[model samples]
Target: MNSSALVKHISECFIKPQYEVEEANKPVYLAPMDLVMLSVHYIQKGLLFTKPPSNSDDQISFSTPEFLESLKESLSHTLVYFYPLAGQLATQVDEARQESLVFVDCNKGPGARLVHATIDMTVSDILTPRHVPAVVQSFFDHDRAVNHDGHHMSLLTIQVTELLDGVFIGCSMNHALGDGTSYWNFWNVWSEIHMAKNRTDLVIPSSHLPIHNRWFPDGHDAPILLPFTRHDQFVSRYEAPPLAERIFHFSPESMSRLKSKANKDHQKIYTDSKRMISSFQALSALCWRSIIRAIRLPDDQVTNCRLAANNRHRLDPPLPENYFGNCINAITTTTTVSELHEHSLGWAASMLHQSVANHTNKALQDFLKRWLKSPFVYQIHQLFDSNSVMMGSSPRFDMYGNEFGLGKPVAVRSGYAHKFTGKVTSYQGYEGGGSVDLEICLPPHAMEALESDEEFMGAVSLPLTGY
Candidate 1:
């Protein structure tokens, strides 16, 4: 279909819930981490795949109606294990304590919203590697999917869009409910249920059941889980104008070269034990340097790199494998543009490595303690600056493993509506075999500069034809 026709088809599409899916269990109080995420918007993800063929002559084909029924059934079954997803976020005031708190009202009513939509476009039409696909934005229900009012919002919304020769399953979940790990755990289990055809005998193994209990140091008093009042507001004073989104693929070989270059100069200065740097650290350093170069910032200006570090494993007496909640904290490192430009790639990489390494068990515990005392002092503005960049998510999240009976997704993208300037999200490349794809959003001029920079372009592989 042509672009205009695709737009027409998308406009003609309609969405409605297949059925009500309520929680199969009781209500649960919001954890401290959950309260911290209450004001954040939903995280959106899309999975695209070709339509599947029928398996049996008598069995119904995977048509729109049949597929919708199957997906709804599987989702309802999956919610049995993940009950909070079907619940709603409600605030309750403690009269005796004169404090207000938020919790998930698992009343087993007004379940998650699952909408069905169809468009006259193919997956190929929306796979442009350099640009954010328009269809990707059309596949989601952004306004209704997010709880901007902080009340009466469904915990999750799933939109299944039908394409000419493919399908797009878009999911939007409240960030206050859980983090990416919890989000993917729900997705993978839902896929498992769908693959099993919602059989009653099959169940998500106990090992994968989500643990809801919040973990704290022994004898430590738990703080009140209330909304942030003053400092936690998202300040937009430093917000830049709208940005352009682009995708760049890095092959394993290019990544290897970057790693080698990042460690070459540092090897002589440090002992063997401390000489090595991780792939993520090296690539982040490269990205930081490239971004600064592309933007042509003043040499004396200070630039920062903020990384979202997962604290699940970093905590002392690590949380359970299935602990499902926000366990990530941001670690920021800063250097003058002059220092960064004058130093070798190894220097930048070493700084990043040490910044992350400094977040030990004690450090993480100390952060939690501090949070308990003042949860509202943080503002989104503090996490970002006009001259700085932030990187979230990981390339190792198994994004391509979500197969809902049809097949593995041909491509997966983080939803576009939620993207912000200077934000970067990393994903395992669909080409597989450990390649990395960086989805970058920046101003138009900066994007153009990065695309034209010879050093930056050298590490980015040529776009694949089939997407």
Candidate 2:
């Protein structure tokens, strides 16, 4: 779909945290999990909502100016609790120590960015297409390249795009700031504050309050320094190969069918009745199998799938669900193409389930110890491979529920950052229930093969993604 030619950029400004940070702007050191993501791209996602009906209560009857002001105001309040995001990433070079450390500098008063834009198009124009419109990228603020770029830019950007009969709130958060769990947690709190009548006096429940303390090993110091004098010395973003991305929506019934089939076939080998296949495992297995078949790799060729697991619960003393930071590790499961494509979906799921189960508390502790010994940074080459598939994001996030005084989102979309071949991100289906949506990125020929694969298409719900 072609976007309207009249795309106008209105205004851009920074929205600081409502309250001043304590200790005269002390630095908050990032943990190993956050530091490893320094080379990745910022996460870009947005929500689409239609124009609210004119109800007598006038809940959403404000004009464009009023709407933008309220969002900016509420965001300031949100940033007060999520104070780290309101700060900038800083590099402290220590010539004596022969190292440099990256930390969040809340001093000097940097703030989240608020960008206002206007585009002459309806919400339907963005949501109706099978492949999302390229114009959606314009809804975001930065033509951002990498998280390392956060050292000199706004760590968080909120661009509100005014539509013909609707509005879109697009966001771009530095990957180093947090993972999807932390990202969605901030969004949920912001929406909650926005929905309140007395926004200032509203008390955030303990359940929703975020804990900002960064995690570390027992003997480690506050900020772990890397053996590099400059940021560019160890961190750089490379050009990723061109890829095609598409979202596939599966209904509750279809999801249940896949889960049941996976469990049913798994019973053939193991009698472990208590350990049935999970919805995540089942769906991931299906995606892995379908992609391997579609790619048409040789029988002996090895293919790997990396599943990201949240470490909050796995920690010895579990962190609070609202603990705001990156606490995730990718669990890689490898298999030959023939082993994956020829076997029942259940077998592949079992492999993934065991991989996740094996990543217990001990494994995470050892990983922390190893990371402290050698603070290695990730690059594009180390992150992706031709024969590997990596998965991020989760279906459990409260994305559809982030109303922000408007109605619930009509759809959830992502920007062009972090796109690599065989990367899949999952979200709860727009209709709720047990439905799921997998946003998949792949090579052009592989995507064509997937679209035509009968086994994968047979389970997809009717009318696919759009409402």
The best candidate by lDDT is 2
Model 1, residue 424: distance off in Å is 0.8
Q: In candidate 2, which residue pairs get closer than 3 Å at backbone N, Cα or C atoms, i.e. clash?
A: none
Model 1 / residue 260 / CA error / Å? 1.9
Task: Tally clashing residue pairs in candidate 2.
Answer: 0
**105-222 per-residue lDDT for model 1 (tens digits):** 6653477778877777777777753677555677765542334333565677788888878888888887767787888888888888888943688967876788766565555534
Each model's backbone clash number: 0, 0
How many residue-pair clashes does candidate 1 contain? 0
User: Where is model 1 more than 4 Å wrong at Cα?
Assistant: 5-26, 53-62, 94-98, 143-150, 217-223, 227-240, 268-273, 377-382, 463-467
Worst 10 residues of 2 by lDDT: 458-467
lDDT against the true structure, per candidate, is 0.71, 0.83
**TM-score, model 1 to reference:** 0.88
Per-residue lDDT of 143 in model 1: 44
What lDDT tens digits, residue by residue, belong to model 2 across residues 1-467?
34554557899899888878673267888888989888888888888888777767756564888888889889999988888888788888899888988888875346788988988888878777666676777788656468878787888999888888788898999888788888999999999988889987899998888888888867886888887887787687666576777789899899999999888878886776568789888888888888878778899999998887888999988888888889997899999998887789889988998899889999999988888888877786777776778787888888999987778888888877776788888888888887888888888899899999888888777643333
Overall local distance difference test of candidate 1: 0.71
